[model samples]
Target: MGWSTKQIPSLRGRRALVTGANSGLGLQTALELARAGAHVTLACRDAGRADGAVATIRDQVPDADLEVRALDLASLASVRALAEALDGEGAPLDLLINNAGVMATPERRTADGFEQQLGTNHLGHFALTGLLLERLKAAPAPRVVTVSSGLHRIGRIDLDDLNWERRGYKRWGAYGQSKLANLLFARELQRRADAGDLALRSAAAHPGYSATHLQTAGPGQGGGVGDRLNALVGRVGNVLLATSDAYGAQPTLYAATHPEVSGGAYVGPTRLGQNRGPIGEVPSTRAGHDREVARRLWERSEQLTGVAFGLPAAEPVAG
Candidate 1:
């Protein structure tokens, strides 16, 4: 009976772009937005699969407004390509769901040489958001929603060795860092917008234990017995505990559409361990609110991604 998709405001004439919209939570997010009358672009890594996703959506909402664009968050060039293409189209984008991501995965680097998790989950979205800032600003009211995770509670950001070059790599730790960065980046963006007097709303959300391919995608990559066990565990968890992808997506939907949702808000399930339930404002870790750390991470992200947000620097507050 809490805030569900039924409360979503009419999105007529609003244009939204959802990353990784080919399946799982991303697809669910895209579908609901389309149902609410938004012209949705499904930016995905695989073109064929994206087509299937579009078809699946159409099957449910026959007149759904949707398009598929190829996007590989593991590559900076690919992120820029999609942003530039949208720029060429010269249409304002009202909603941007930075939802595409990889969970715990084997040690690997993106095309830009950053750790794959941080690159895809944080840096890639960082670049895309910056590159498309103008497009967003063109709209009367613009919002960006970045998806994080409950695992972020344990994340520690190591600015000096963010790519994990100096220390030994831990897959879960890397994912935690990326998800934590999502929350940090979201707040920083809002701070910058307020400081610059820009009309932009930035928010973050986490799908509390959603049954998606993300749980198994990473573990399924290895051929070892441990990997197989991990994959089996993920599948079991999906069936036994996790909520449906559509249900998990409610937080993101609420964060994206709820009129009362303010800038810098972090939305998540409001139940046991924040894993599943009605959506509401949830507190992030203490680290997620460290202004100085968020500022530093923002600068580091720009340096690593080579994408400037082009917003004014926040003035120092007088004591």
Candidate 2:
């Protein structure tokens, strides 16, 4: 049988941190993890929404061991602050789900001066993961699940114009690049863990087409007419064809909990185009498997975020 959330083993005593947990796939992922007996921290950018998410989960789980913390992925400072706070807790974090990200939006730079989509979706998680490596290492069989999207196949990582300084920033293309980076990071992290003989495992998952706030929030304000129209089309598509957030979250939950899932595994829905269905170990993109690109991206990410891999820096060619 295919993997399902119902098949998740007891996560008692495990500590998990899920970014973007205030809504959508992240919220559902956190809620299900809590139901499975894991203590989950919902790392979000807004406090009020986080609190609301907490209340929603408590209404169901009632005894859910949960915490809400501030995490603005667009700001490296905020990412570092979250890492520092977790370090202060001095507890092992068994799961680090880099589930926060932004979709298509108007051209904008992050607080750190990088393009918004790439900055929040990829760079921020890269830094946070590096900063929390030690805490994850302290746990038994630690796993990091990076959420990506199917649009990654069209992404081209313009090393020269990574921030879109030269390329005039096509919204969808930029979003694609960000999603591609997520997979590359997950793959490279797994290779690095193996090179260092660490017990930590890293994998990637895609939620498929799901209806969530990311659909509306991306084009609510500041985004141009093109983005707004895009959002309108997205809303219609989601209403007609997209799966629910709970169903969309299954791939991530499967990747996080399934023991049979190996490092560098790419999990997604097992239907047409891997859009929506039960979770399955899917094939990664050609770029996602490129060792050369992953290496350069890793180095560049370290320079951009100033957070190095916590393990003995081993440069391994990911196959």
By TM-score, the best candidate is 1
lDDT of 2 by residue, 1-319 (tens): 7677889999999999999999999999999999999999999999999999999999999999999999999999999999998899899999999999988878899999999999999999999999999999999899999999998998988887889998887888999999999999998899889888989989999988888878877765465676677778878888998999998999999999998898899999988889865688898679878877888888899999999885544565466
Clashes of 1: 0
List all candidate RMSDs to the true structure: 1.0, 1.6
TM match of model 1 to true structure: 0.98
Cα lDDT tens digits for candidate 1, 1-319: 7888988889999999999999999999999999999999999999999999999999989999988898999999999999999999999999999999999898999999999999999999999999999999999999999999999987999999999999899989999999999999999999999988889999999999999999999977668888888899999999999999999889999999999998999999998989867899998889988888889999999999999988865665566
> Which 10 successive residues of model 2 have the least lDDT summed?
310-319
How much is the lDDT of residue 64 in candidate 1? 99
lDDT of 2 at 155: 91
In candidate 2 the C-alpha lDDT for residue 236 amounts to 88
Give residue 61's error in model 2 in angstroms: 0.4
Which lDDT values do the candidates have, in the order given?
0.93, 0.91
Worst 10 residues of 1 by lDDT: 310-319
